[model samples]
Target: MENKTRTLYMIPYIGWIILFVVAPIALVVYYSFFDIHGNFTVGNYGKFFTPVYLKMAISSFWYAFLITIISLAAAYPTAYLLTKTKHKQLWLLLIIVPSWVNLLLKAYAFIGIFGAHGAANQFLDIIGIGTKQLLFTDFSFVFVSVYIFIPFMILPIFNALDNLNPSLLDATKDLGASKWTTFRRVILPLTLNGVKSGIQVVFIPSLSLFMLTRLIAGNRVITLGTAIEQHFLVTQDWGMGSTIAVFLIIAMFLIMALTGFRRRGA
Candidate 1:
């Protein structure tokens, strides 16, 4: 009776949640089963498993995975260094500043840097080494994604390290453990949950990148996001678009759930 009463009292908030979240997802599911002709079928999804779609999915994951790895490697050491610094506020400010810039603008800014005959090429010319094309390659997309998402990876691990008790490290050292040993055994385990969360943050958004790939990656690169956008907006194949979208959402949700479960288990 008490639970029912509480549930009833929360109806307004629940309605808002359903309105903003659940309803959109339900619509996506409904749309995915229908083709351009609006007939009920899984034909769109069946076509999705073909060699082309499979290749797109694989490439998307491959690029996203590389970004996640690069984000972790870059963020982890930078975060650890922040832990030892007295000027922690400055580091925090620097990390938060880039996040204020719009995503599209950041992607556009990289266009001028990575484009053929852009700044990189000019620098190469000055050095007499010639220029290399960066556009549309895995290197261009994955590298820019990593750069953008480094902050996401940094913040979680920083929080974990900041919340750590200073005495714990001191105690480990006093007990004859080397710095690396103490880090490996105690600090690393304590921070694993945060790193896991950060990895998910970096990984999931990288999967759905559209404008960045469209810009810095240009014509030669296509991912699941690009495919969905093209199908819906250009090709007028909403069924195929919805199917790809549904798969992306499901994959993201499953990853989040697994990350949560891993944290709880730890």
Candidate 2:
């Protein structure tokens, strides 16, 4: 009876996945192979290998890599510090509060901050430093991407650090191991799962960020997500767009596998 109840509870979730997740993927696969007229061809897939598309693919991965590294570097320490704080939950709530706001709104907010006559440049001008073009640059793009996604990175690492055994730290210290050595050999290894989870959450979304790239980078930075948007909406090339979508899906799966999210012995 308990097993049957558990199975019943899973039915709705299973149905939801099939209806939303599986169906959409199947549609994308279908569209990828068929033109607007419904004729089948592999040309759409071949187009991904073209120089422009290839460059976008490389650029997307490169930017995503940089964002992941930066987020990890920043989040790990922040999470560790939070663990040591008396008001850890409050601090975490503050960190996550911005994420509750819509991403598009956040991007637009940054646009004002980074705009030429905006806060960043204006502050520079006040300090006797000349204004610089802060928006529509690689630095701006990566900075915004990191800002948007760093919370996702931090939460997982925080959970990991919070759940870590304090006795291990005491054991390491009692053995005459320094703080850095204890962290490197003991603390880091234990919390690696959280780091992996954070990477999966942050890096995959970073690769396919379209709105922030447009608002912040202003066409100066092109990514795979931008290509998909162009092909789907601007160019009206559904087949090509679906092909890139399929490629992105595959790339996300590869990332998950590499990050140890994939199940073993399955």
What's the number of clashes in each of the models? 0, 0
Per-residue lDDT of candidate 2, residues 125-190 (tens digit): 999998999999999989988888899999999999999999989999899999899989989888
**Candidate 1: Cα lDDT at 108:** 82
TM-score of candidate 2 to 2 decimals: 0.95
- The alpha-carbon deviation from the true structure for residue 50 of candidate 2, after best TM-score superposition, in angstroms, is 0.7
**Predictions in order: lDDT:** 0.87, 0.91
TM-score quality measure for candidate 1 = 0.92
What does candidate 1's lDDT look like per residue over 32-125, in tens digits?
A: 9998888999898899899999999988888888889989998989999998899997978798799889988988888888888789779988
After superposition, which runs of candidate 2 have C-alpha atoms over 4 Å from their true positions? Answer: 262-266
Off by over 4 Å in 1: 1-9, 126-128, 263-266
Which run of 10 residues does model 2 get worst, by summed lDDT?
A: 257-266
**Could you list the CA RMSD of all candidates, in the order they appear?**
2.1, 2.1
